[model samples]
Target: MNNHLSKTIKNEMFSHHYQLLYNLNDFKPFGVEILFRSSLFSNPQRAFQKAKELNKLYELETTSISKAITDIHLNSIQGQIPDHLFINVYPSTLIHDDFVKTMKNLIEQTSISASNIVFEINEEELITDHYSLHNAASNLKEEGFHIAVDDFGKGYGSIQTVIEIEPSYIKMDKFFADEIEYSTHKQEMLKSMVTYCEKIKSNIVLEGIETPEQFFKARELGIKLGQGFLLARPCPLEDL
Candidate 1:
């Protein structure tokens, strides 16, 4: 990272950015994925990686959640709350004792419906303890909050985790979406995953779809929900 980027990340100059997930069948807004962005960085992923390196991932995740809830509350005042709000959380963060308590308190304080909040667990990190992960997921589900296994195929124990945690949604990884128009193998793989999701009765969301061809392919594969530059790009809450 450049010097300015380093400073910006350290100072936490990030703002909550949102990308709209659309229902492919009708092209209607289904939910908004909460993302963090900064002027110094093109995307939030780099800054998040830096935070993880510095052991500040938990702090950053909590702060982002608080801000996102605040944004949702503000939007609710204007009758602008979408069907759902998708918030990303690491498995490590979910396993922490304080995570669930803090989240519940925030939801209470903000007066946001727990049912409308979908916690999309980022599956990129290693899950050392499946039992703890399942317990945490169960607690959130018991509270009526939805759970989603994000980046499904790209992560460790993707299938086993889904079977153990039983998320309401399974997000197809972008790797399968990229250049899918030309690859027959990828198309077949996506079709198989869609079948599995159907068997499990879990909804699927295709991520990183940046082209019309990719979007159409996803629809052909029977994916109902999707997020990508072709559909909508990340923007400030005010822009929505």
Candidate 2:
């Protein structure tokens, strides 16, 4: 495909694709998480990976952010906007020089409060420059935007990273939630993290919850927010 055609197709894909997030407490609508989908890829993970391979990950992230903000404004006009919108951003992308500037511009353009949007950082990738990451995070926080470290425990020095970034939210990786009913170690780890979060005043969000058992287990462990199939599945804004 030529450059112009590819750009047009990508723009169209961004327009039609996105998912809604929900609160686990009352199962009420929470926010939207932008997703990329097409005939060539069945899921956002695959599509994002392809973008990375093509060295277009930054462009993809920028487009997703813009589209998400626009969608939220449209929903607001319809009186269907939620509490917070979660946008998955790569750590590298967050650290870019123009990243925060672009975010400010989008917030201004959409008339969305920075506090209503949470930048969910994927911690699975190695963050070699902690200083840059910390700087970017600090800048966002100062701007009143919330920050979350996604897939928390699965990454390197996650606890340390959490301390450094001082995220407003920490999403517990699903691996810990997989079989907590049977795994004593997982239960203890979660309990410990909960205690840690309490000390830091950071909220916890358990992801990938798929069963009633898992949902109850997470609740028992004092997880206030959660995202999973049991509580709610991803859907378009109109469906929400």
Candidate 3:
């Protein structure tokens, strides 16, 4: 799988797709979360897991990110950009020693401002070094890249991470979006979260919204941003 994955990345067999994000206020194209897809794997997560096992996760991650940024920059220059680019990133990769240097080089080569990129921090892994992660995240912010925390309350150091990093966006886990319209408790919970996010000026985005009912409910509750199949799926950039 690693060899196959290497070939895919090396040959650019993989493509970057956009998952459209909408402003629930008026359903306009707010931005896109850039996603990677390849015919070699029906599930990209499996490939990422394999990369981690092989200790080539950094190579795999940085290579794809560099490609995505370069492509998005050129596309934007050619009138292909609809809005900002949100790219998913791993915490470990972000804190790695070479991370900042690699990113700076990309920015220099592409001439794309950090403001144009939002690095969504994937909190799926257990955080072993909060201090290192915090310093790295802070440095990214200093470099002008917006930081978003993914799976906000469903991971280790959920609250501590939020307080430490103070992400520019808080992406609520899909568990809260599951039939939330039917649960008063869930509604109240979301409302509380919404309030807190608002207070801190960190935009709150609801993920996995697949129905009009959930969409409208989220909007009614003051959610300003959302993403899911109902709005759009991961597809080739040209499709957008």
Candidate 4:
């Protein structure tokens, strides 16, 4: 993968999950997107330790912070609660049969409706074989989970992955939002992507909308949903 940033700058990725809401005002509130950490592992030994600990607790094929999400959901079921949950899946692990089976069981046991679930795919890493990754995505789609291509326009496989996966949602990165104020080039790129997405039936969600100007700009571009500090920060489940 090409390092898009300077080597002097340290990059850190912390995985956190958030729910996606369609219509921003819908009662039933029908859609969700699970965000994942995009930065690569910093320490080999510590990463291994984290993975081993996660593997012991969850049925995921790999041990990583993402497993923490599955563990929480697997143990979250109790008396009456909402029947919706979205989880992240790394592109590298999407083809693991056991992991997928474990996910199916977790959703089933919790009685979570599949329609409200979304599998967010982070494209920071290049997918050498689009066919395999597309197949894995298609399998999850077959089971009724909405697909979302995360960090769109900020990764190596942005356009190709969008073409192949054909996710239900395309999340715009903060890079675009920050540049839209001064760059006609960025605005044109964004508008073209939105147009293509519409032609293919994909909804656009602008991530990292931090100011009123940003929000209105996205709205002007026909973006239906906007997420970021401007709208609402990620709150705890109880708070949400």
Q: What are the clash counts of all predictions, listed in order?
A: 0, 0, 0, 0
Query: Of models 1 and 3, which has the larger lDDT?
Result: 1
Off-target runs (Cα >4 Å) in candidate 2 are 1-10, 15-32
By summed lDDT, the worst window of 10 consecutive residues in model 1 runs over: 1-10
Question: What TM-score fits each model?
Answer: 0.90, 0.90, 0.94, 0.72
**Highest lDDT scorer:** 1
Model 2 lDDT tens row, 133-222: 999999999999999888988887687779899998888888987987788898888888889889999988887888888888878887
| Order of the predicted models by lDDT, top scorer first | 1, 3, 2, 4
TM-score for predicted model 2 compared with the true structure = 0.90
lDDT tens digits by residue: candidate 4, 140-197: 7888877787778787788888888999888887888884666788778778877988
Candidate 3 backbone collisions, by pair: none
| Candidate 3: tens digits of C-alpha lDDT, residues 1-240 | 668867876787777788898999988988899887767877777667777887877888888899988887787787667556788888889899999889988988875788888888888877888899899999999998888988777877778888898999888888878898898887898899899998998999999999999998998888899988898888877777
lDDT of 1 by residue, 1-240 (tens): 445544654565678888999999999999999887766656678766777777777877887788779878977898788778999899989988898889888988876888989998888788889999999999999988999999988988898999999899999898888999999999998888789888988899999999999999989988899999999998888897
How many clashing residue pairs are found in candidate 2? 0
Taking all chains together, the TM-score of candidate 4 against the true structure is 0.72
Per-residue error for 22 in candidate 1, Å, reads: 0.8
